[model samples]
Target: MTTVYIADTGVFVRCGGPDKSKFQRLRRALQQAGVSLRIPQRVYQELGGNPAADKYPSGDIPYADGFEDGWIVVAEELDYANPLVSTVMDEVRRFIANETDRDEDIIEKADTALVGLAAQVLDTGEADHVVLLTTDKPAGRAAEALLPQHGFSDSIEFRYVSVAYLESLTADEFW
Candidate 1:
C-alpha cells in the first residue's frame, strides 16, 4: 500500500532554522526513504504568510531547498467542488468547534484544511494510507477521529510533529 505523507507548517517550524541539524536530518531521512512531504495549500500559506514567523529561529525554513530537491511538494489545490471534500471539511469544522467548546463559526476552512485534504486524498483513492504530520492537536484529532468512520479505519495516522520527534526521526518513520 502506498503511504502518502502530509506535512503541516509545524513540521517545518519544528525543524528549526535552515542550518539546524534537525532540518538536515529530516531532509536526509525523507530522501533516504524516497518519499516527499505533501503540504496542503493552507499550510504553504501559513509557512509564508506570517512576517512575524520570520523572527523566530525555527521559522527560517530552507523549504526552497526541499522543493528544488523534490522531496517537498505543494499538493494540488483541495477540490472543494467534490462533495466528499466539502462534506468532510464541514464535519471537521463541527468536530473541532465541539472539541474546543467554541462556536462553529469560529472554526474556518483554513483551520480544517488539513483534515479536508486528507479526506479528499482518501476519497479520491490517491493514497492507500495517509499519515498526517502536524502539531495542531485539534485538527490532528479531528482527522484521526472522523476519517475512520468514513471507512478509513487503520488507514489514517497522525504524528504530532514535536521538536524531539523531528530530532529523532529516521527513514523508518516514513515506512
Candidate 2:
C-alpha cells in the first residue's frame, strides 16, 4: 500500500535554521528513504509568506534545498469540489474550534487544510495510507479522530513533529 506523507510548516521550523544540522538530518532521512513530504498549499504559503516569520531564527528554512533535490513538494491546490475534501475541512474547522474552546468563526481554511488534503488524498484513492507530520495539535488530533470515522481507521497516523522527533529521525520513520 502506498503511504503519502503530509508535512506542515512546523516540521521545517522544528528543524531549526538553514545552517542547522537538524535540517540536514531531516533532508537526508527523507532522501534516503526515497520519500518526499507533500505540503498542503496553505502550509507552503505559511512557510514563506509571512515577512515577520523571517525575523525568527528558525524561520530561515533551507527547504529550498529539499525542493531542489526533489524531496519536499507543494501539493496541488485543495479541491473544494471534492465532497470528501469539503466535508472534512468543514468538520475540521468545527473540531478545532471546539478543541480550543473558541468560536467556530475563529477557525480558517488554512488551519484545517492539512486534514482536508489528507481526506482528499485518501478518498480519491491516491494513497492507501496517510501519515501526517505536523506540530499543530488540534489539526493532528482532528485528523486522527475524524478520518477513522470516515472508514479510514488504522489508515491514518499523526506524528507530532517535535524537536526530538527530528533529531532522532531515520529512514525507519518513513518506512
Top-lDDT candidate index: 2
Superposed model 2: Cα runs more than 4 Å off = 49-62
Q: What lDDT, from 0 to 1, does candidate 1 have?
A: 0.81
Model 1: ten consecutive residues of lowest lDDT: 49-58
Q: After best superposition, candidate 1 residue 65: deviation in angstroms? A: 0.6
Which residue pairs clash in candidate 1?
none
Task: Provide backbone clash counts, one per model.
Answer: 0, 0
On a 0 to 100 scale, what is the lDDT of residue 59 in model 1? 50
Task: Give me the runs in candidate 1 sitting further than 4 Å from their true place.
Answer: 49-62
| Tens digit per residue, CA lDDT, model 1, 65-116 | 7866878877777898998788888998999899999999988556688888
State TM-scores per candidate: 0.87, 0.89
Residue-wise lDDT of candidate 2 within 59-118, one digit each (tens)? 444566776677887777789998888888889999999999989988866668999989
